[model samples]
Target: MTLNLPQLRAFLAVVDAGGFSAAAAELGMSQSAVSHAVASLERELAAPLLIRAHPVRTTALGERVLPHARMALSAVRSVEQIAADATGTMTGTVRLAATPTVCQGLVPGLLRHWREDQPRITVRVFEGDSGEVAAWLEDGTADAAVLIDPPPAAARAFPHADPGIQLATDEYRALLPRDHPLADEPGVDLRDLEDDPLLISPNGCEDRVRTLHRRAGLRFAPTHRVRDLATLIRMVQAGIGVTVLSEVSRSLIPADLVLLPLKPQTSRRLVLTGPQTRPWHPALRTLAESAAGHLAPTTARPAEGRPLPSGTR
Candidate 1:
């Protein structure tokens, strides 16, 4: 069973606080946000983690699991301790696989900060498409990776609790040739490009891209299908096609292409995933937390879009 540390924390908090409202008060979040966090965790776990009494209680499964969850969370906390300058150093390499786009954006900034703080730690990066990123983790080729958050379909197949398939809470914009007709449009709908080619990562991670098109009633047939962001952006710059991208993807977009906001907004997950069964390592956990820090507030993008449209069918 996958115990998502954050979700498990929320579940434990609700249990300790006696309900969502109390948990929210203690956590400094709105009650609705607390409930949503718990529900999101339940979605990933695929089992109930709590029972609602006058004061909520852990289900037998939750009860059996809480102690371990507490232990795991505590361990996770200890691992992140090294990330704090006062906590001392973490030495060794952390092999990471990340999309070509995230590698270019988030990693660079984080590395600068990391190197200054922890001079001896080494980081080796493997760049690949989302599917390949996931493959490296599945095969133990890398310690961890950041891939697009799993879509519901992919999540159903993998069915392990982790970061749930959720859109990045960020806006997505369409990249088009500078002079393309849609450049002037403040927001373009997916159906508007029915006959045009679409470029993006192929295979399972294309879920967010395809779901956006299908929801917008757009039929995105790729004229030149490619997986790498650098290549995709080059093609779009060449006026070959348009592509959907997260804000982070813009880091790779060329000067020649224009970015347009998508009307029924869409975003993709830059999820951090690794083998759940592998024993947690200090080096690995520090890497995970460090990786998480790259997306930290100093690195966080502003929320800039409405939810994607319904009717993916």
Candidate 2:
């Protein structure tokens, strides 16, 4: 038997308003209609739901079912609220995930733009490696993400999805000490660093770095490995070893370190991606738009598959 919403609502209104006439007035229905609705509900349930008296009240079974009715009604209203929020006005929380470097270098500026443009929308950011970010998007832990050169395998994981917008293409740069021999060069080639100690982060860029090396007909065996980008930069500053990273990561580099564009111009694409199978929140679209605007003016798109050219920045 179907538990009708209107009947349940009528039953609740009569109890709350204390009488059939009062509930009818509250609900803008006639007293007879309200009484019939309650009676029909009790008949369908095969139980007396309410006592027909001067002051209406629930029977024992009615009391037990009241909470469930309220909850179901509340859920329906919540769905409506979500629809309302999705259509026109932008408000509420927008959760985003991104890699550490993107969060450090690019996300702050995008956040500033959002704060100025849409103060009503609150944004929460989660930082992870590229792999973790992709997983977060796939598993519904995050609403959207800034992913770096997502591979075909990862996209296949989310079939029939939007390929996402390419925010900017960034070439990897060499972080070296001021006195390093390659520090003065306009650009350093990946092959040139074959014998030199290469320091890298174990977080996300390892695979891309290796791919770049392989394309250049060289092997990438990092002599040093660090967990975070800051430490990698510090290691380079201390003259421990040279490290490579994107130009977007310029914000994290120390003042004492030099940034040289890589030779053969290796670079990766930064994409703003969201789930395709699920509804994409409007606030996330707004965030993505702001990111595109912020990145477009200052950063040039790196030629696809080009290695970093030597340059001082």
Candidate 3:
């Protein structure tokens, strides 16, 4: 049996774009054409690769095939880049994954800079929760990812990926209603908020918040578990409860809500790294280098406070 690039591209586009119609739009092809390509690929392999559904997902066999497909496509891109390099032009697409917080906070500036500096290279942003983002990098859905306080063991977990570069470290702060009692303070301690209901979002910072509570000898219990940052902010604005979030997330919070530095402040580092199970796409190296220059390693301290100690991994 013979496989081909168009079939593999169609399969990956369908998976990444989440549907044949969307994939066709991204690939600038007819939806039926994309579907036909995927079907042709499945026929060649003699196995169904995708589970046709609303969102479109990979089958068990597809999961096993994803990394190899990504490597193949990336290898082809590398070969294309070689030709482009010889002509003094570099071009390729890089898929970047990040948690919602980083998407809202850091990605905009980075994308803006990349757009100006690397005009030919395209960067696509995929925003998800921490676990989903990590999985995307591991499974080859994303070419690179910005991870929040990634554990040291991640180096071992993603042996094929580059050792991550420290992008930025931002401290966690208290999110409270404007009129709340602690809102008037320059900084609030975990113990100080213990009497009030604690709201927590399980995005990327839940574990860090739990650690903060434990360090302060408080329980990790949260009165409300919110999954979306906007909804969590709305709840805080409505006086439902107070929450703790990173300082970088200030853009997402409204003016009516107050953000105060945490006493004995804690911070989380953000690292940018490539996919774990595939060869680095040619454009990812350039993106990383641009990011390193665009974002200098610095701690995002609160406006009202000095830098605090770093949080545990």
Candidate 4:
């Protein structure tokens, strides 16, 4: 049986975008067209691939086919990139995933640089929680990602995959209500806020925050666990409780909230990485290399807290 590119792409798009309508929007196709493509693909394969529901899900067969579908699409992209490279004009879309903090604090500058340097290559950004971002990269939903202190095992999973490039090293800071007693202090220790309810966002920084408490010999108890950074900030503004967040998240903090250095400071490395389970796109490789040179000396900061060793992941 003969398979087609559009049919495969539609299948992958629906899976990645989570629904036919959303997939159509992403593919710039009519909903009927996207639905038809997937249906046609299923007919060719003689099995149903998706379980149609709100935020559609893949059937067991579809799950088994997903990796092959991604690889097939990636192979096509590689061929196209090869032709473009031979012409000395590289052009391709790179789906880049990042946590909300990186999206707000770091991505704009990187986009600006890419726009100027690699005008033909399109870079699309996807913002999610840290776990979601990593998952996207691993699953091929994103071509590249800005990862937060990715573990060593993630890199080891794909020996030939592009190693992560450090984008920035940002210290974690204590966020407090403006009128709080310790808000005026130059720095605040986790112990200093022990009596106050500790607010923490479980999006990406929860483990590091837990590590901080452990190092300080304090319990890892938190008063409220927030998932969204915006909601967390609003909670802090309304005097719900103080929280710890990356220094890069300062832009999201309002004037009424104060961000002070965390005593015995800790920092996490924000690294740009390609897919661990697939070949890197040519444009993605170029972007990764460019980022390493562009951000290295400039964004690197001395962390008073124990920093993860270089090339840790």
Give each model's clash number.
1, 14, 0, 0
Name the lDDT of candidate 2. Answer: 0.73
**Which digits, one per residue and each the tens of the lDDT, describe model 2 over residues 235-283?**
8888788888889898887778788888766787787766645545545
The alpha-carbon lDDT assigned to residue 30 of candidate 2 equals: 96
Worst lDDT 10-window in candidate 3 = 304-313
| lDDT score for candidate 3 against the true structure | 0.81
If both were scored by lDDT, which would come out higher, candidate 2 or candidate 4?
4
Task: Give all TM-scores, in the order shown.
Answer: 0.58, 0.65, 0.85, 0.85
For candidate 4, write residues 77-126 as lDDT tens digits: 88876786678677778999998888988899899998988888889999
Residue 287 C-alpha lDDT in model 1:
50
lDDT of each structure? 0.63, 0.73, 0.81, 0.83
Residue 95's lDDT within candidate 4 is: 93
**Candidates sorted on lDDT, descending:** 4, 3, 2, 1
lDDT of 1 by residue, 15-105 (tens): 7567888888766788888788788877777888888777888787877766676567656644564464355666665567777777887
- What TM-score, to 2 decimals, does candidate 3 have? 0.85
Off by more than 4 A, model 2: 1-88, 152-160, 297-313
- 273, model 4: CA deviation in Å? 0.9
Give the range where candidate 1 is weakest over 10 consecutive residues by summed lDDT.
304-313
C-alpha root-mean-square deviation, each candidate: 16.8, 14.5, 5.9, 4.5
lDDT of 3 by residue, 6-53 (tens): 999999999988999999997899999999999999999999999999
